[model samples]
Target: MSTGKFIVIEGMEGAGKSSAIAVIESILNKQGIAYINTREPGGTPLAEALRDMVKSVEHQEKLTVETELLLMYASRSQLLANKILPALAAGKWVIGDRHDLSSRAYQGGGRGFEQSIMDTISDITLKGFRPDITLYLDIDPHIGLSRAKARGNLDRIELEQMDFFIRVHNKYRELAAQDKAIITIDAAQTMVQVHQDIEKVVIEFIAATDLD
Candidate 1:
């Protein structure tokens, strides 16, 4: 059997990543694909603890950008080592709700960390694991924040101001521009339309890769 595909959905807060993941899971189920749906910063027990530290609204000790970056990677390392790679080796598609892009966008762009620093952490922590395809849901920061607010219970990252999110969005665009493996989708469209677009992309990617 072929190696499993690693697909990730990424975006700023409240860009409907969770919804998109659900849609993707449904499609994968319909296709009888063995897949694992997971999220970064919390995929493993240790990683989940790290996620709480990173996202706790009350942990307002003002972490340095580099420190934040390191914590993110720490969680990622645990997740990849304990959950992601094993599933992939077992021929299960790993659909991640978020991935390394979140680090590049949030810590690198939003926090104004150097690209070299971000790259170093990613390289060291991930070794060579890269997503087969990354689906970026593009939405206006303001709109996304509004959606997030409607959902209530803002985490530390979600509580960040609009300016921070603008930076994050810009970084996402930059990363998408630089990488052929990343696909950006207009997320302002209705949920049905967004799901249709995502489905089309998944079909094309699977066909191009010749995955069973």
Candidate 2:
């Protein structure tokens, strides 16, 4: 049987990833595709635990940047090994809420980690696996943070200062431009318009994948 395709939704907080995923799910349902959805740093049991540790604002001691990066990859390894690979092998498409691209943007770009270090860690964790397509919802850091704050409590990362998020935003844009598999969507638009743009890209991807 052919391996199932992997599609990922990527963006900084408040970029409307949940809404975009809903649109993809609707399209996949209409196409009668069998699929599963997963999220980064929290997909499986161990990963979920790690996710909590990383996100919990209650940590009396700050989580070091290096520890945070490793924790992210550790969770990814579990999810990939115990869930994602098996699902794809079973020919079930996977809709991912976030993936390695998050690391590339957040840790590599936002944290200012060297590309070589990022490359080394990525190779160790992912080997060569990657999503077939990633829809990146792009928005200004100021705007995105406002939206996130309005939704209520922010995570440890979300609680980061505005300047930190600005760095993340720049990294996201930089990496998205260089990668063909990554499709950028202007998320500052009205929800109606953002959803429309996402729907159009997903439909096109589905059509192309079906042909392939």
Worst 10 residues of 1 by lDDT: 59-68
How do all models score by TM-score?
A: 0.96, 0.97
Give the per-residue lDDT digits (tens) of candidate 2, residues 179-207. Answer: 99999999999999999998899888888
Q: Please provide, for model 1 over 48-142, each residue's C-alpha lDDT reduced to its tens digit, 9 standing for 90 to 100.
A: 99988888877648866667788899999999989899999888999998999989998989999999888888899998789999999999999
Once fitted onto the true fold, the runs of candidate 2 whose alpha carbons sit more than 4 angstroms away are none
- Runs with alpha carbons beyond 4 Å of true place in candidate 1: none
lDDT of 2 at 205: 84
